[model samples]
Target: MINILKGMKDRHSDDVKKYDFIMDTAKKIFSKYNFEKIITPILEETELFRRSVGDETDVVSKEMYDFIDKGGRSVTMRPEGTAGVVRAYLEAGFHKADPIVKWYYNGPMYRYEAPQKGRYREFHQVGTEVFGIRNPYLDAEIIKMGCDFLEELGIKDLTVELNSLGNVESRKRYINDLKDFMAQRFDKLSEDSKRRYEKNPLRALDSKDKGDQEQFKDAPKLYDYLDEESREYFEEMKKYLEIMGISYKENPKLVRGLDYYSDTVFEIKSDKLGAQSTVLAGGRYDRLLEIMGKVKIPGIGFAAGMERIAMLMDDSLIKEEKKGVYIIYFNETKEYFIKIADIMRQNNIKINFDYNPKSFNAQIKKANKINVEYVIILGEEEKDENIVTLKNFITGEQKKYSVDEVVNIIK
Candidate 1:
């Protein structure tokens, strides 16, 4: 037999059902916040990601699945959601559509990372983006929306880690100070951290390497270097969060792994996910639109991995048991069964037809397997009498009814 790809797995029916449930629930919650749905192509120009996600980041430098297409154009499978959204926003002139445009999207993202628990090379994300507004209250609402989503999934023990990377000037000063700090401990740094230190030193703070983490222990905090304007912005964001009763912890080391992010950055962590604990994360990227499209539109958004959210989901939170009718018919009664099935369907009643010409016992067992509430049995005798037998699997009651009566009962 041919083998499946190392990083991809075929999802079974149950897994697909769970994925649908998660997507549906997320859409409902996002709709309540007035976010319209938008979907972008999975394949995009490779430069879009390199320019937007940043060439210095791992997503662009290491994880991106990029190749030259037949047209000799550099194309890539998107590794994240925000870049594509911004591209669409600029292409469609959405900046002129509304002063504040809010949109949500859910789809597969491709990356070439080593697959681990709750992480994959091909993963799905449900994300939201708000453009044109830089209000702190909107930031607080976005954070609350994330919390609301996790709560709806019944995920427990979530911690919100918040931080401010400050403005460009403050961040630049902090990065220089951090580089000087890391320079002394350079010999103790990991190989990957060393490369990051040379290219994007701020990203070294986000390193998972044990030795590099220790080296960053004495690094200067970005908050301390924040100028008065940036400090006030961070304080105002926290004030809005407090007003909304959203609790968060300040993590000085929480500079998100993206270069576009500025001011507020946050990660919603769940203890249940172990080492890959961040379930949802994003922050303000006020200059991303300007950098990408030469159009200034401040934006803030977050993306949550569907796989990670599904891992922490409680089965009880998703009601998967569907109530419906199953039809069990013998060969001779096929015509009558089909007619009844049509009538039930037209009435908006859920019906499952068992077309096999098997024994009554075998057919009824199949019906039980599906756990349907009602099973309609049609045999030669019932067909001749223009009636059908209805069995209430829940109550173990059996009765004969006219075709109209059966339709009414099923309805």
Candidate 2:
């Protein structure tokens, strides 16, 4: 038999249900902030990510699932949500809509990488983006919303890591200085760090190599190079976060993976998922839209991996079963049970009926297995009297009720 692809796995009903619950919760939370839903195609031009996410970044250079299409045009499966959303915003003329546009999207994202627990090649993300806003308070509000959503999911013990990449000029100076520092120990650095040092020095700060990390120990911090404006912006963002009663730790080395991020960047981490602990992360990208469409638009947003969140969630937190009535009937009373089920369903009551002919005891066992709220028996006596035997599974009480009475009770 052919096996599933590496780095991918099939999700059964239970897993899918949990995934849906996460997305639904996110939708409700986002709706409270007046953020509308937006969806972009899975396939996009490869250049979109290269330009917005940085051509030198791993996502564009190594992880992207890119190939030439039949038209001889290069396209890539979206590895992240932000670039596609930005592309759609400009292509669909959303820039002409509102001065401040808020959007949330949930869908699959593809990347070519090694799969580990809670990390997959084809994973899902629920992300939010706001355009035309530059206030530091708005940044705090977004962070608060993300934390609130995680708290709602019963995920506590979260640590928020905050940083500032500063404006373009400030980042440029920091990168140059970082390069000079890394240059002194180029031989001591790992092969990957040496390559990153030349291409994208900021990424080297985020390197996972032990030798590179040791090299970064004495390297200059990005915060030291923040211009006056960037310093004030970072300080203002922290003040707002403090005013909102949100606690965060400043990480001087927290340069996010994306190239477009600037000023404030934050990540929400949980101790539950080992190694891959980050549940949600985002940063301010004021110049992304300008680079992508030549139209300047200030935007801030965060994306959370659905797989990671679901992995960390407590199973009891999700209401997996829909409480309803299950009908158990003998072969002779199948028609009667079907009619009763239809009536209950028409009245907006959730009802299920067993199609297989089984003994009374066997059908009752099936009803119990499903954990239905109530079980209805359609035996001969009840069918003749035009009444049904309704048993409350929770209360263990049985009563005889007319069709109308049963409908009322269930509804």
Candidate 3:
């Protein structure tokens, strides 16, 4: 028999509950900030990612699930969200339509990589992107909304880490200097780090190797190489976060795993996830549109791992939602039970019932196995009288009520 593959999971029971909670909480918070939902196709031309996300980054070079389709066109399952959103923006001519736009999206993202813990080959993300603004205050507002999103999910103990890549000129100078420093300890670098250094040297700075890190101690900090303009941009963004009461720490080595990011970049991390602690991360990518569509626009956004957030959520903090009513039919025919259920449902009461007729004791046993709080019994007298025997499992009480009366009580 065929079986489920590795790095994939079937979400049910409490896992489904957690996903539902994450989406509902996300929509409410994103709506408050005037962000509209946008969904792009799961597959796009392979060149889209290679151009926007970069050809050298691990996402494109190693992780993407890409292939030549039937039409002999190279198509790829989306590895991330930003590239698709930017493509849709340009394809739809949104740059000419709206002066400023706020959009959010939630969907599964594909990658071909080893999975660990909450990380998966087929994972999901809920994220937002804002266009046509470059103000540092706007940057802080996005961070504030992100924090509120996490807090709404009952996640706590998050640390906000900030860094700046500056513009192309500033970022370039740092990369050149960093390459020079990394070249000295070429022999000490890990195999993977050594491979990354050839094309994308910035990724080597993010190495987890102890020996590589030891040699990195004296390496020049990216912040030290930022030009005066870049310095002011980073400082102003930090000041805004401070004024908004959003605490942050400067991580001079925090260059995210993306090439489009520029100027201010930040990550929201939680120690609860152990080694892979970052739950949400984003940065300013002013030239993304320009690179893909040759349109000059400023945009900033962040994507939070849905699985990671769900794993970190404290169930106690998010109160269990009130469940619907359950019906246990004891009559030969479920005619009365069906009628009562419809009436209760029409009145906005959630209703559940046994499809097969069962004995009085048997039906009650089934009801006890589930989480339904209120159970209705359709025995002889109640079925004949067109009434329901409503039993309050919590209070240990029972009463006979007409169809209308049951609706009123349940509602």
Candidate 4:
């Protein structure tokens, strides 16, 4: 039993350290862009997702981790960020206060899918949402923010795949056309695509079915259905991306598996990760707030999967900063330990010491294991002289200092 459970990871220590670094870096970049942070509950009313992510999407149909709560209300862990952000916007009345709302959130989202290199039952995402704006410039700004984040993480060889899912009129016309085209291939589609055809025929374009992909090669692209207004809106967005030196491919078939997105959908892909590889995915959801009943506002945003970013980058690159000292004390000094700990902490110095008592030799080995830059030995000689022996682990240098001097040396 233990062996089987051990094989499943909550996350390794190194993986967690990298995850923290990614979150911190993402927050810093988002803050620079004047984006505020907002976190919604992990569990929410199940219908919220069923409505927003689309009932036909895999996240809503098969993958969501949903169950009845004690109150008998069906609730599910959030599979995506946009829906919950919209819910919070309506529930909190933020729209009345700020004409434009920009928020960032980082947390784990649950989905009951087979765990793979990047996909997991529980995974982390750093997402940003901007509400109450529909200008093409806002869409460009959000895309640039996502690009900036990946650049900060030293990830390269990434290509942004851009697609505009046309406005309501265009979508309505295309769906009708697509429905008619697929009627002929109803028998040719995989069982999954056939089911998707019944629920959302556009989603069949995103299907992995070999027969579906072949069918789409000659199929009518969504771009053909874009009304002049939607086409002009899309052209302006691409022009802005070019001005900012952001390269992208127009992938008409990249329809994000959601109902809220109206125009300017995009995904950032890296060649380092094999095929199912999207490090960041999001776009303009012009009707999300209106559909959620907040306001008739339109907005654009994007979310980056922290795990996929970590997977592409070197794992050794995201370690935490070393603390100023690693404390080493004899088990017998339990009486004075709290006093010394308090002093170090109050002086704004970081110190690491396990509470578990161990032999002096064992403690030294453990100190080396944590790999802190310096170690402080509180042995009999130093305690007798009211001094501490400080050793620089990196340089193998040692010095003795009084209590006040120890504080000075560290602080």
Candidate 5:
């Protein structure tokens, strides 16, 4: 049972260090871009996902870990952070905050899906949302934030793919056009794409079906369907990326599989992870708030999957801190050793003394096993003299210091 739990552990100490570094660096970057931090609960009312993520989307249809709580009200572990943040925006009345509020969140999100490399049932994401703003600059700013984050992690050869889903009327026309295109190729589509034909025909563009692949070669591109305003917004976004020297590919079929997205959509891909490689993705969802009961607020944002980023991160960038102090006592003076260990702890020193009352050799091995730096030796002579022997087990160096001096040095 212990071994099983160990294998399934997601946030080990080393993993925690990586997570902290990513979040801390991301928060600093987000703040520089005029974004605040907003943390939402791990769980929320079940209806929130259905409305915000759309009931037909994969997040709602399959991935969500929704269940009825003890109160008999259905609740779900959040599959993504944006919905909860949006809910909080309305619930906490942040709607009145100057018409443009930028916020970021980092935490674990639950999805009931099979685990894969860099993709887990329980995963972590760093997300940023710019609420109450529809400016194309805001969209470019958010995309740039994700771009800078990946670049900071030492990832290279990344390309951002851009698209626009357009406004309601334009989208209606495109969907009909796409639906007709898919109808001719229905017999050739994969079972999954065939199922999607009636619901979301746009998803067919991303079909993996060999038969459907050939059909999409001449499928109507969204660029043709973009209205003047949407086309203008996309052009401005491209100009900003050009000004920033951010190279991107325009993927006409890069429609995010969600209902709320409109006008602008994008994804950043890293060549490191082949096929299932979207390091980050998001777009403008101008109609999300209206659908979720908040009026007249359109937002744009994106989220980066932390697990995937961490996987591609260079291990040399960070060396995990493992220099902990261990208290080792032999024979007599247990009380003195305990008191001294307590003092070390009070001074913010990570001191570990096994309370199992084991032999000296066994305790030393345990200390080494746990990767502690200095093993503090307390014996009759040292205890009597109000001093202690600090041993650098790694280098086999021993030094004597008065308890006061030791306290100061450790502090």
Candidate 6:
């Protein structure tokens, strides 16, 4: 027998309920921010990530699932959401038609990597992006929206770590100094950090290696290298964040694991998330569009790992949907019960009936297993009279009621 694939999960019962709660709460908050929903294809050209996410990044270099399709087109299951959204924006002529747009997406992202606890090969994310807007207030607003989204989900103890990546020139200067510093102890760096040192030295700061992190202690801080314009931009973003009551701390080494990010970058970390503590993270990608298609469009956005958020969410906080009604019937009245169950369903009631007519006690045992609020009894007597006995699971009270009465009472 074939078993379920590794790193894949089937969400059912409470798991599905929790997933629904997360998405519903996301829609509620995203709509409040006036961010329209955009659904992009799960599959896109593999070149999209190579261009936008960067060739040296782990997401592109190590984890992306790309292949030549049946049609001989190189395609990939998206490893992240932002790149696809940008592709959609350009392809739909939104660049010329609607230059500025606030859009959010909910979808699954695939990565070919070892899965653990909150991290999965196939994970879901709810993210938002604002295009063609570079205002500092909007930066703070986006971070606040992330905080509000988590707060709405009852996941607390969040730390907002803010930083600046500077522009192309400022970053180039910092990268040169960083590469020189890391080269002195190249052998001590982790294999991943060593690979990143030459092509993308900034990612070394985000390294999890103990030795790499130790080497960073005396390294040049990215904040110190920010040019005048980038410095002012970071300061303005901090000021607005303070005014908006979103407490944050500066992390000079908070360069994210992507090649496109520039200017202000921030991550909202939660203590409860263990080592993988960042519950949500995003940064300004002022040069990404320029890099992708040579069209300048400044954008900032954040993506929350739905699985990670669910990991931090309190079980009680995610309200489980209450079970409705279960119908039990005898063998002789199977057809009668199905029609009655259909009638109940048509009346906007959630009803489930035993398909194979079972003993009265046996059916009630099944109903009890489901923990339904009520059960409809359709034995020979009830079937003959065109009436049924409704037993309230909670109250343990039984009463005879007509089909219409049953609908009204359940409704």
Best by TM-score: 1
Q: Which pairs of residues collide in model 6?
A: none
Candidate 4 residue lDDT tens string, 1-411: 345331135777778788877888888889999998998999999989887787777888898989999999999989888889889888888788876888999888888878876667777889999888888877887888898888778787789999989888889888889888888778888887788776877788888778889987777899999998889999999999899889989988899655667989999888885664778988888887777774787878888878788888766566556566878887666556667778888998888887885887888898898888788888777766767788888899999987778888777
- Least accurate 10 contiguous residues by lDDT in model 6: 314-323
Residues 307-384, model 2: lDDT tens digits: 988888877877856778888888888778778878888888887766676787888888888889999888989888
Q: Which stretches of candidate 3 lie over 4 Å from their true place?
A: 257-259, 274-276
Predictions in order: lDDT? 0.87, 0.88, 0.85, 0.82, 0.83, 0.87
Please, what are the lDDT tens digits per residue for candidate 6 over residues 1-411? 988777777779777888899988888998999999999999999999899888777788889989999999999999999999988888777778768999999889999899898788889999999998988889999999999999988888789999998888888888888899989888888998888887777888988788888978888998888899989988998999999898999988889656568888999999885664899999899878888877888999999898988888877876555578999887788878888988987988887666676778888898999899999988889989999999999999999999999999998
Better model by lDDT: candidate 2 vs candidate 4: 2
Query: Which residue pairs of candidate 2 clash?
Result: none
The candidates, ranked best first by lDDT, are 2, 6, 1, 3, 5, 4
TM-score (C-alpha) between model 2 and the true structure: 0.94
* Candidate 6 displacement at residue 371 in angstroms: 2.1
Clashes found in each candidate (C-alpha, N, C closer than 3 A): 0, 0, 0, 0, 0, 0
TM-score of 1: 0.96
Q: For every candidate structure, what is the RMSD over all alpha carbons to the true structure, in angstroms?
A: 1.7, 2.0, 1.8, 2.7, 2.8, 1.9
Candidate 2 lDDT score relative to the true structure: 0.88
Alpha-carbon runs more than 4 Å astray in model 2: 257-259, 274-276, 394-396
Q: What TM-score goes with each of the models?
A: 0.96, 0.94, 0.95, 0.90, 0.90, 0.94
Residue 362 in model 5: shift from native, Å? 4.8
Clashing pairs in 5: none
Which is superior by TM-score, 4 or 6?
6
Count residue pairs with overlapping backbones in model 2: 0
What does candidate 1's lDDT look like per residue over 46-71, in tens digits?
99998898888888888999999999
